[model samples]
Target: MLNIGVLVSGGGTNLQALIDAQKSGIIHSGRIVTVVSNKPGVYALTRAENAGIDAHVITKKECGSSDAFDAALCAYLQKMQVDVVVLAGFLAILGDSFLLVYKDRILNVHPSLIPSFCGDGFYGLKVHRAALDYGVKVTGATVHFVNEITDGGKIILQKAVDVLEEDTPETLQKRVMEEAEWKILPEAVELVCSGKVHV
Candidate 1:
């Protein structure tokens, strides 16, 4: 089984999805071994604790620099023998050291259909708001490999959701999470763990 290490910064809805998926056997050949959050008191850590998984908080203020923080995070994952690193709402920017160490072993779930409402500055509600503002008929989520450039990673899977005129960013975000993000993130993890996914 692949040892999965999840990184989170906020609510951890995606992390919950992975946990549920693993429990349901939707994510085969892998299990969440640890959860790391940059901020303390985040609900994600609570979820991990409730699930009896080892959870950690490594605040950036203590790390001194972004590179240092990334290195520290990578070290923790390596120590845990993590086979896959999933960025589930993890807001920290990982540097070259981390990226090079993890390489295609790292994955991220973006809230948009990628190449649209993605890249720098497009996160959380901002992605949905941009999609609504652009008047796009459909918007969804993308699961991709993590690379040097933000959200510029190679795409693994994408699932689209229809846009409704009455939808707000909050509603749209929820829809995308349910219809796309939550579903695919675990599947992508499974694919990688099962050796079906190629870099």
Candidate 2:
């Protein structure tokens, strides 16, 4: 089985989805071995602990530089022999140094369809808000590889969710998470782990 190391920065809703998927045998090709958080004391860490997964914190402030943070994160993931890295609600921006080593091995789930309300300055509720502002009739989630460009890697899976007329960013965010992010994120993991998708 492949080892998956997840990176998180806040509430681990996506991580929880993966854990549930694993428990239900939706992801049998790989197992999540460790979870690293960029922010300490986030609920994501608690979720990791509850799932019996090893959890640790490595903040940019702690490392004192982007390069340092990347080095630290890469070192830890390498030490754990992680075959795949999943950025589940991970807010920290990874640098090229780290990206070079992991290359296509890193995967991330964006809240909105890529090339839309995505890229720098678009994350969390901001993505939903942008879609609403743009009056998009449909907004969804995307699972893609992590490259140097923001949300610019090859996409693996995407599931669209309707944009309700009476939706706030928060409401739309919840719906997208339930209808798209939670589903395809695990499916994408299965695809990557099972060798169905690759560079």
Candidate 3:
């Protein structure tokens, strides 16, 4: 079985999805062994602890530099023997050293379809707001491997969600999470764990 490590920086709603999916037998080829949060006092850590998963914190400020943070994160994950790294709601970008070490082993779930409202400065409700401001009729989620470029990696899975006429950024965000992000993220994880998704 593959050992998974989840990285988070927020509420961990996607982390919750993976935990629930694993409990339901939706994930069998791998299991979440550890959770690392970049930001301390986040609800994600609480969620991890509630699920009986080991939780940790490592921040850039503590490491004094991005490169050091990357090295620290790499060392910790390596020590844990994590086979797959899932960036559920993780915010900090991984530096080159870390990316080179993990390579295609990291998976990230972005809020919008890539090549769209993605890359730097596009995250959280900003992505949804961008779609709405542009009057898009459809917006969705994308699950892909994490590379050196922001949101630039091999696509694994994508699911589209309609943007309603009356939808606000907050509402659209909720709908996209429910209709797209929640579903495809876990499916993508299962695929990677089961050898169905290849780099």
TM-score of each: 0.98, 0.99, 0.98
Worst 10 residues of 2 by lDDT: 112-121
Q: What are the per-residue Cα lDDT tens digits for candidate 3 across 1-199?
A: 8999999999999999999989988888999999999999999999999999999999999999999999999999999999999999999999999999888899999989888999999999999999999988988999999999999999999999999999999999999999998899889999999999979
lDDT of 3 at 138: 82
In candidate 3 the C-alpha lDDT for residue 53 amounts to 96
> Where in model 3 is the C-alpha error above 4 Å?
none
Q: Write the residue-wise lDDT of candidate 1 on 1-199 in tens digits.
A: 9999999999899999999999999997999999999999999999999999999999889999888898888889999999899999999889888899988999999999989999888999999999999999999999999999999999999999999989999999999999999999999999999999968
The global C-alpha lDDT for each of the candidates, from Candidate 1 onward, is 0.94, 0.95, 0.94
Relative to the unseen true structure, what is the C-alpha lDDT of residue 97 in candidate 2, on a scale of 0 to 100? 95
Cα RMSD (angstroms) for every candidate in the order listed: 0.7, 0.6, 0.7
Q: By summed lDDT, which 10 consecutive residues of candidate 1 come out lowest?
A: 65-74
lDDT of 2 by residue, 35-68 (tens): 9999999999999999999999999998999999
Ranking by lDDT: 2, 1, 3
